[model samples]
Target: MLSICKIYFMLFLYLSINLFIMALYFILLNMEVFIEYNLLSFNSLSMVMIVFIDWMTLFFMSFVLFIAALVTKYSEDYMGLDKSLNRFILLVVLFVLSMMFLIMSPNLISILLGWDGLGLVSYILVIYYQNIKSYNAGMLTALSNRVGDAALLIAIALMMNFESWNFIFYLDFFKNDDMMKIIMFFVILAAMTKSAQIPFSSWLPAAMAAPTPVSSLVHSSTLVTAGVYLLIRFSSAFSPMFMDFLLFISLFTMFMAGLGANFEFDLKKIIALSTLSQLGLMISILSLGNSDLAFFHLLTHALFKALLFMCAGMIIHSLNNCQDIRFMGGLSLYMPITCTLFNICNLSLCGLPFLSGFYSKDLVVEIMSMGYLNLFVYLIFYLSVGLTVCYSFRVVYYTFTGDSNILVLSTLNENSKIMLSSMIGLVFLVVFMGSILSWVMFPFPYFICLSFVMKMMTCFFILMGIFLGYECAKFSLEYSIKAVLFYNFSMFSASMWNMPFLSTFGVNYYPLFLGKIYMKNFDQGWLEYYGGKNLYNSLKMSSSSFQLFSRNHIKIYLLFIILWLMFMVSFLII
Candidate 1:
């Protein structure tokens, strides 16, 4: 009963957000409703006037209210389904609120608060099922996020040291090249970790342990978009180093995840790699500083990716009774609506002509063609795009088509009406989003739509992947084992981060066992054989004593404690 009531309330909220945003959308998404506001003391202002607002504020506000609705809808169905629904809903709402504040925050301090809030919420959501697997994934997300958060924090401290926390004041803070470089370094680091760029990307796939709705929110729109938003926000401050970072990270991640997705067997894991790869596409586009294209891609990607994810959720939910694609096959006939939605969503995701991704993504491609990237790097990107088609089609194929089309999938379709409705709505977007976007941008007109030679390549790969999946279906067992080895090795290597070192050594020195000297610290390379990790462990175990003694000195400990609090207080105060 409580679940039902929450669903009703959520529906009410969703409707309200739609009504409110729709009223503004005709006036906003079309016109220049993105007002940059100025503020004076609220003391003399009317209650309404005292509340400052802008397009960004509206975006945040609408997003939160809509998410609240989605949560309510999700909650009504998920209640009593997952053991930790209460905490999950709490975190979801809190996470939405956090992103809301982040979108409107004109200063860094408020954004950090939102950033941290999402992190905590994501952590809780990931562990909502509360098993050893979920716990480990949650911990991984927390620790990895800190790498990004720490960078942003260091950058913020440096900025606040010189100038106020106002966006306008950022120029003053970034006047010195060294300080700017430091800030860029930290921001890039944070962005990399947050964005799940390669070497740090393994966590996202692991995060599939999270429930479907949580995955929908995190993977589709809110959490991952933060990194892209950061890059867009700080477009001017980016230096050669920063661009190099973006260029390399974006290219490498796109290629890596593209390759990873081709080989991944876990249903959610494939989508996870796809998410990282597409995000890499966005980053590569953003690196060109073509804001319009990047922003449009952001909007388009938001729709199709969310649609695709929700569809993926539908597949996973219906078939995955705690099992993944490893257990799922031949589900097309039972869940026809879902299968059809998945196909359209993937077409859009692959930038099918006259589809949603075509205009915005192609715009990025067009712009990059005019940029400084070498031909080989561009070739790698184009090939990655081909991989997108391959995996997107593979996901659809494995889930839907089979040598025996009408085969009974052992899973039941238990999707709630609200979940089905959300899925349907996203499908609507998948089919018509290109038309909707055509009005806003020039990618597709009513009579004609955008398609390049790239679409032909995508088509080729997708057709090949479908045939490959079909042929490979016989060798499924062997493929699964090999896939497990490859994916696990990649994941394990990512956890170790020693592969880059080895790659370097392979290039420079012996090609076999070619590990770097520095990476000897990360892997049990020499450590497991010789007691390197154990030796480090012993030092760490006893190092606390050395640290405690230093800390136990009255002046030192007191100063340290005060300084720590001081650091925190200054951030909040800023």
Candidate 2:
């Protein structure tokens, strides 16, 4: 206990130091223009918002402190009893500090460096569990993130050649039409990968292979949101093509993930899919060129998503590390506080009115009413919201409200105060997030209230989802690869990941998966047959022939045809 306290104290103390430095940097930026300050740095010179919104950096960093506190306290219970507990705490501290630096950076070059540092540390934490499975997931996650890094670096190279790299520089000067379009392409591709849109969505769901605390920070708070945050930050120079690209990709990711979460059995995997769905919504909202819509959702999503993940973690922890929601039930009987926090998170994620998610969710829907947003776009976003409710409620009902399946009644689950306290505080924020967002004035208004009729009508979807999700739970507790892969829930679908067993389980399904198997074999056969003997023998026979042209009647004919065409052109010219 003393060791845990010491670790928490050190982390909190370090965060407090960072917070203090940010405040001082902010103050210095606001000071009347001095010769000394102007010579010190371009970032300090260019920042105009420092006088007023500089504290926003401090606001974002407060969450860092909160997460660090949770990591330190939670590690004490999960690891402090272990021999290497202190090392774990040190690593967590370093990871959060890197995130703070990354997010608060003012310049593009600084931002890229900070971004790489952030990815490296989070990659380390994901594999810190040290299992082979964790290592594999970590490597795949790192590789996917590196795709974004490459795109970002390429954009930087282009900017340097054209001599336009900083946000302030772009705002003040340099707008070449062709160069701007090229830069936008690289920027959007990088953002899409980091945001986990569609094909790149494979990685985030696999990231559930990480520890629970790591998921809270990676999915709920920072890494996944970085791309959308960048989109919101650098949206000024976006052309129409860029916005259209962002809109379509964001909607596509939403539907793909929303459908997949419905079939997942693992508790963490469900939240992971839900995270993808939410990120999709976030990017879609930002793509509309409304900074308020993007920023409002950004703040609200953090509270509710974090609350949901922490609650899911508590439920899994209660079962002696069982993760599949199939075996979990009757948790309301065992842990009332756990159920209450879980319900609050679900309400917010599902966009229950007066909840934080409702404010941002409604704002995005309302913005869609403008001629700019088509019905097809609105339909996808709204349907994903309904599906979001379906899966989120599926988690709560399957894990808590239903009959007991593996109910071991030990001393009741009061979720290790370390975890519960952070969750409880977050739950409070989730309940009031809309209230806070309604007051946000960073840019345009995203605080539009929905009419009573629409609010009343939207409730029907949530109610229907809950009823259907409950009904679906009773018949089948089994998991299948087809269900998992189709919905992109690769996290908990290990059963058939390698061995498809597509035919063995009384199924004639998915000719595509079988085609891939044959394709692999087919490619190898061509390589061995042609390159090894057939093609090699053909080459040798051709070489051994005394007269190369005499043996090939077809080549001699082609030479005459080419010479005739050349002769025709020469005659015409003469």
Candidate with top TM-score is: 2
Give all candidates' CA lDDT scores: 0.67, 0.70
For candidate 1, give the lDDT of residue 122.
Answer: 86
Q: State which candidate has the highest lDDT.
A: 2
Candidate 1 accuracy as TM-score: 0.74
Give candidates' CA RMSD values in order.
13.7, 12.7
Residues 385-461, candidate 2: write the lDDT tens digits: 77877777767778777687775564447748777776776677788757754664333453445567665545767
Stretches off by above 4 angstroms in model 1 are 1-68, 78-80, 172-176, 320-322, 403-411, 441-574
Query: Which 10 successive residues of model 2 have the least lDDT summed?
Result: 31-40
lDDT of 2: 0.70
